[model samples]
Target chain A: MIRFENVGMRYGAGPEVLRDISFELKPGSFHFLTGASGAGKSSLLRLMYLAHRPSRGLITILDEDIATIPRNRLPELRRKIGVVFQDFRLMSHLTCFENVALPLKINGAGSGVIKKYVSELLNWVGLADQANARPATLSGGQKQRAAIARAVISRPKLLVADEPTGNVDDALAVRLLFLFEELNRQGTTVLIATHNESLIRRFRHPVLHLEDGQLVPSPLRPIVPLRDRAPPPPDSRRFSDPIYPDAPGEGGRHG
Target chain B: MAKRRGDIPLGNDPASRLLPWIIGFMAFIAALALSGALVLAAFSDRWSAGLTGTLTIQIPPPAAYDDEAGFEALQKEALAAVRRTPGVASATLLPLDEMRALLKPWLGAGADPRDLPLPRLIAVTLEAGEDVDLADLGRRLEALAPGITIDDHGLWRERLTDFMAALQLAALAVVAVVALAAVVMVIFATRGGLLAHRESIELLHLIGAHDRYIAAQFQGQTLFAAIKGGIAGTGMAAGTVVLLGHGAAATGAVLPGALVLEPMAWLWVMTVPMALIVIAVLTARRTVVNALVRMV
Candidate 1:
């Protein structure tokens, strides 16, 4: 669970990028964060992910105050949250498998568990064939999926994503959302920031709309608690041969 | 816990390339200096023991008019006079053959001992508990045989000890300076690695890397580099010291201590690499930890 009240953030000495921001995310809920360019969506996500300290106001994640928690304890809290960065910041030198396995490694998972779980996650994300490929060789959409796999590989309690579906096609995008929705039903709170309007309408999740660093009120609330709904089947089919992203004007460079 | 997963990607750091060589060179210098100090310490101990409570008396040969028997009698008289001196433990007239053997190292083995006119020398040992007054002893010997000299070896031992102690101090100073230089180089290299991987480090932090985890990556690289450099440098230093000792012996010169190292001394020489490795690893760990704390 994340709660932010009157939180304002800015780069050192710069004008405030996010002002009077406030929201409460209940446990096991999923929401879409929507805004235009310079709407401070990324800034807000940065705070939620514990990347930057808020310049003012209170932000709490999982009952720990971001302002007062000791720096040494940050790692334990951070491990519980997964993040899909906007640029898909994978280490260029690591293979796709290695990148995805990093979170588990950091969590001190056994080698057998790491190899087994990482392989299963990569297969689910349609990247099993690209396991040994480095980030530089992967197409844009492939890179995004690899980043997504890494973020979710640890099965983090809270997953924050920034433009995670940007480089994928509509079908692939919907599949990724369904994957997120599946994760939500399992009680992982999910927040995704994006500029895609059609995906927003299709999913119809509660929207945290930001304009000029302010959150606009939305009448639509949570449809129901995720625990009230039946979980999706484990063998639900996905786009397995994700070799090509068919989204308009964003087809991957490789295929 | 993944094998070979150093998330920082530090292998590409130019610091990694240069650390071993730098540490190797420093270790070499430190080993040599340490060996020199050890040898000097051994020399000081040996010389101090050999010369303590010993004295020598030089009796000039009889004048031209005196017959061989007369000169012999004069030598006996002077030896008796020294024997009667207070605090004299034992006195005996040194033989010509023994003198030749003692001088063999300085004067080559081929040199004829009988060719030169030599003075009659008296070997004297003093009582351990008693201090001999050399001025009185010299005066008494001179009365019996003019131009007699009592050489107590006191001034010579004092000067030699002072000189050797200063050399020991200098050797120790060299070891200290070399250690300091190694620390500085390791610090610089660690800082370089930190700078080169700044972005990866920031990413590491965001993804939940503990400060200790990041430090261990640097330390692991340092551990290998230090071992590589330490062994090579120490091996070279041992070889060089052995050669130096052999060269001193090969010259057939009577140099003090002869640069020969005892087995224990050689064991001491081996510590240089172990010490160098420890210094490098510790410096790297401290540097990484300090630098990481300052990171965003």
Candidate 2:
């Protein structure tokens, strides 16, 4: 679904942050992106999401050359891809439900359909009870889950997540991975960027490693394990109280 | 969608909300200047039309002769010449006392009427839509008496016309300058608003919102403010004009029913708000689009 050949990107006239990058992902395939801090992983994802133009080479998404596509058509192309940001960039003023429903609304979906689907997705992510709560009232883990739900709400054909499990616990991280795995099985290509070595070892997907400004393909690839996996407890189990706190009204500041 | 998320979190910045008021004030000044020019033009047109095809035939003093007999013969000859003219509607000879009263204000109250050798005045009214043949009339008058001067009043009327045209041009120039300044100010204010909301705007951009959508939000908010400002400013200007007209009316001599503001002038003042709203909307839209295009 996505192909990048000899792509290079730089901010202003400075040296390139992502250089000589080349990659191809078939439809419904899954991959992992790994690197240390300042390894140009975010810059690569920014390019993939159509936020930045490649300074040097060809970048194609869904069989069309992105560099040649007119700017007025960029929004339609962006609607086909989903991104989970590392910072959980949810509008603080919006309720959890509104945050998740953004992608559907932007696509001009019918209101009734959006409401039903967004609520179900929130329920799947274990935040149905906190749907009306603001992002600031929710804990870090709750915010992360909300962001993930928002990214996948439109069932985007391509999903890119940067540190999707950063704020969650180990079990919750595994649960989130299972969600990604389920999405892939349902034919959504996934590219996840993370620093969790243990999590990487547990998954059997091919890894795209980045060092400095170059892409280094892994020589030893793990075969896919032949069994369905489920995320574990105590998040998997019923908690004593609600996962997120109640939101304060009237004095809340919206940005 | 999704219950609108509480009014879009717009007009959050104080400056953004206040921008419309500034535009409105500028629009008000524009309305006042334009209306003033229109009134001046109308007043000048009326004065010129009243004085244009007519003349005051002043009978000069007859040398080495009796003053009364000379004046009577001049009056009879001037009346007969005016009646024979094609465009003359009516010719009336003023009495001596009346002519003295006409010059009383300028020449002073204590001046001796008998000592002053004032010219005999003949008030000639012309047909409203007809032009007088001034050369033919002048020849006829010279044949009757060489001392009579036919004043068609063109010189004074031309001076008044030039003065009115200049006033109109100056007023129009003031309106143009105010409009230009308003657009520039709006651009600056919109840029400041964008900078203040930079974080929110970036997040919206990352979420696949196009530049046009973001621009619409800013333009819509600014336009609303401009309309409110326009109405307030224009209303104030109209009130001031009416108050000035009333004050001028109270003084019965300088502007004796001649300083009236026309209805069309008031109608133009009413359009000030709409012009301001359009300017605010367009300027905000352009500024936001330019700023957003620099992002990617």
Candidate 3:
């Protein structure tokens, strides 16, 4: 679970890229982050993934304050969250199999476990034949699939994808989205940042829309003021009930 | 099979090859300096022990009595006086031929030593563990023959010891300078390697790899290179030392027999390469960890 209240972030004295942003992600839920170019979608994702510190306000991930966590302890938190970058930042020297196996290795997984899961996930993403190929040798769509497999291989508690389908065709993009949905059904929280509204329409997940360093209210899911929402239940199954009830709207409006 | 964890390909960078050669050259200099110090120390100890409690008595040819019999009588009296000393173990007169051989360096190959007014020399040995009053003995010898003088070889021994000490100190300084240079070179190489592999490092970091994990890759590469270079350098130094010892022995050089290192000294020299490897590994690890601290 992640909660951000009045979080404002800027890069090295530049004007604030994400300002007065507030959102919450319940466990086992999926949401789409929508914005135009330079709408601070990536910046928001970076903060959520513990890559950057916000200049102002509080961020609590998994019920722990981000500002107070020691730098040494941040790696442990990072290992629990898997991030798929828009550029698909796979190590070029590593082959496809090695790239996807990285997260498992970092977690100190056994060789047998790594081979079994990495191989299975690569096959699922239709990259089994390309497993031995380097990133340079793979096509863009293949590279994206490999990156997705790497992100989900560890089965992290929270999964973040930045423009996961940016480099892939519509069919491939739909298939990748289904992969994310399958992961979510198994209890992993997913927040995907993209500008593709047609995909959002095809999948009726709640949307967090950003415009000019602030969150713009989406017609389908109404924004509730931080003070207006009731306290979450003390039980572990707080996400058993939907946070935002289903709202009817056309999904391709943002696109 | 899945690739082994933490087995990243870090040492393959072409620029990383520079560290080993630098370490090897440094190891060579360090081994040479260490060997020189050890040899000098051994020689000094031997000379000091040999010269202790010993004396040399030289009686110049008596000017008043030029005949051979007159010189013989004076020499006989001097030998008798030395034998009477309580701590004197044995005293023997140098044959005329032997005296001429000692003068060969200054008197030239064909010069007759008998024509020159060379002093009659008596070699004196002392009783083991006995202390002789050298000044008292010198006065007694001078009384026996007015021109007779005692040389204990103390002055030359002390001077040799001091000279050897200074040489050893200089060699130690060379070793220290070489070690400092090696550390600096390793630091620079580690930073350059980090820069070249910046993307890899960043990816590793983002995926939750500890700083130590990243540093180990660089440290392992440097350590291997250092060991390889150190062996080459130390091997050359050992070969040079052995060859020089043989050359000196064949030429009948004045150097002491201790110039050829004992087994223990060779063992000490063997540690030079190992020491260099440790330094390289530590320097690379520190440089990399510091650089990583500056990142996310």
Candidate 4:
């Protein structure tokens, strides 16, 4: 859960990019952060992910005050939240498999667990064949998928993604949304920042719309809690079966 | 393959590649300076021990006793006086040929020994735990044979000891300066690496990598480079010292055997590489931690 109250952020002496923002994200909730270019969407996501300290006001993540927490303890909190950058920030030198496994490695996951889970995640994202390929060789959609896999691989409690569907086509964007939805179903809170209205309409998640350095809340019909939802089918949880039923296991391979 | 934990990509930069070579060069200079200091210390100790209870007597062939027989008679009388002194343990007169050989360096090899008015030298050894009244002995030798002079070797030995101390101090200063410069270079390289990999670093930081984790990557890289360079530099320095020692032995008379370092000095030389590795690791770690502090 993340809460920001009257938070303002600026880079150096520049004008405040985000100002007087107030919001709260309940545990296991999902929301879409909608904003135009330079509407401080990324900045808001940054504050939520504990990447930047707000210039003013209180921000708390998982019930701990962000300002008062010791710097050394921040890493533990960070491990709980996953972030997918707009640029896809995959280490160009690393293979897709390595990039996806990075979060688990940082969390000190055993090598066996890392390999098995990362392989399964890569396979689920339709990147198993491209697992050994470096980011430079991967197409934009592949890179985006890899980034999403990295963000979700560690089973982070909260995921903040900036423009996750920005560079992909509509069909690929829809598939990526399905991935986020699956993560949410598993009790992960997802806040995806994007300007794609059609995808936002299709997902029907609550929106935190940013305009002129402030959050403009957009309400929607309340969704049911994750615990109240039915469990995923046994075959859906099995690695042998593809997570996405409609897409062919070998389809959507990008270079 | 799954990437190992704590593995960072910053070391791929060209700046990182140059660190080992730079550290090696610095280590080379440090090793040479350290070896020089060690050798000088050994030489100083030996010279002090040898000269502490020793004296030399020089008798010029007075115009009154110019001939060989007269010089011989005067030298014998001076030798007898020195031997009779309370603290004088032994006195041995230098043959004319030996005196000529000692003067050969100042006068060319072609110079005839008989042409020069070289002083007749008598080496004196003092008894242990006994002090010789050098002035009294000198007066006694003068009464027995004119132009006889007592050289206790103290003045030249003290000056030599001072010279050696200054040389050792200078060598130590060079080592200090080289070490300081090495630390500065490593700091600059770490900063360059941080700048080059800022994006990856920030990504790591956001994804739960601690500052120490990031620093350890830099530290490990720098330490590896430093150890490689240190071995190359120290090995080269030791080889040079050994080669010089051999050359000195071949040249004979140029340097005393005591000037060569003892086994302990060699051990001290062997530690230069290890010390440089520590310096590189510590410098890199501190620089990285400080740089990361400025980030979120």
Q: Which rank order by TM-score, best down to worst? A: 2, 3, 4, 1
Chain B TM-score, candidate 4?
A: 0.80
lDDT of 2 at A201: 70
Q: In model 1, which runs have C-alpha deviations exceeding 4 angstroms?
A: A217-255, B1-5, B47-54, B59-74, B78-120, B125-150, B253-257
Candidate 3's C-alpha runs over 4 A off are A219-255, B1-8, B46-54, B61-63, B66-71, B84-89, B97-117, B127-136, B246-259
Which of the two candidates, 2 or 4, achieves a greater DockQ against the reference?
4
lDDT (Cα, tens digit) per residue for candidate 2, span B51-91: 87578888876765466786688779888888789988998
C-alpha TM-scores of all predictions: 0.82, 0.86, 0.85, 0.83
- Residue A147, model 3, lDDT: 92
How many clashing pairs per prediction, in order?
0, 0, 0, 0
- Work out candidate 1's RMSD over C-alphas: 8.1
For residues A122-221, what per-residue lDDT tens digits would candidate 3 score against the true structure? 8778899998999999998899999988887776668999999988998778777877876676667899998777777777788999998899986444
TM-score for candidate 2, residues paired by index: 0.86
Top candidate by TM-score: 2
Please identify model 2 stretches exceeding 4 Å from their true place.
A129-133, A217-228, A231-255, B1-10, B102-111, B251-253, B257-259
**B77-150 in candidate 3: lDDT tens per residue?**
88998988888899999898887888888878788877888888899999989878777777887877786888
In model 4, where do residues sit more than 4 Å from their true spots? A169-172, A217-255, B1-6, B45-53, B58-81, B84-89, B95-121, B126-149, B249-253, B256-261
Q: Which pairs in model 2 have colliding backbones?
A: none
- Model with the higher TM-score, candidate 1 or 4: 4
Minimal lDDT window, size 10, model 1 chain A = A246-255
CA error at residue A172 for candidate 3, angstroms: 3.3
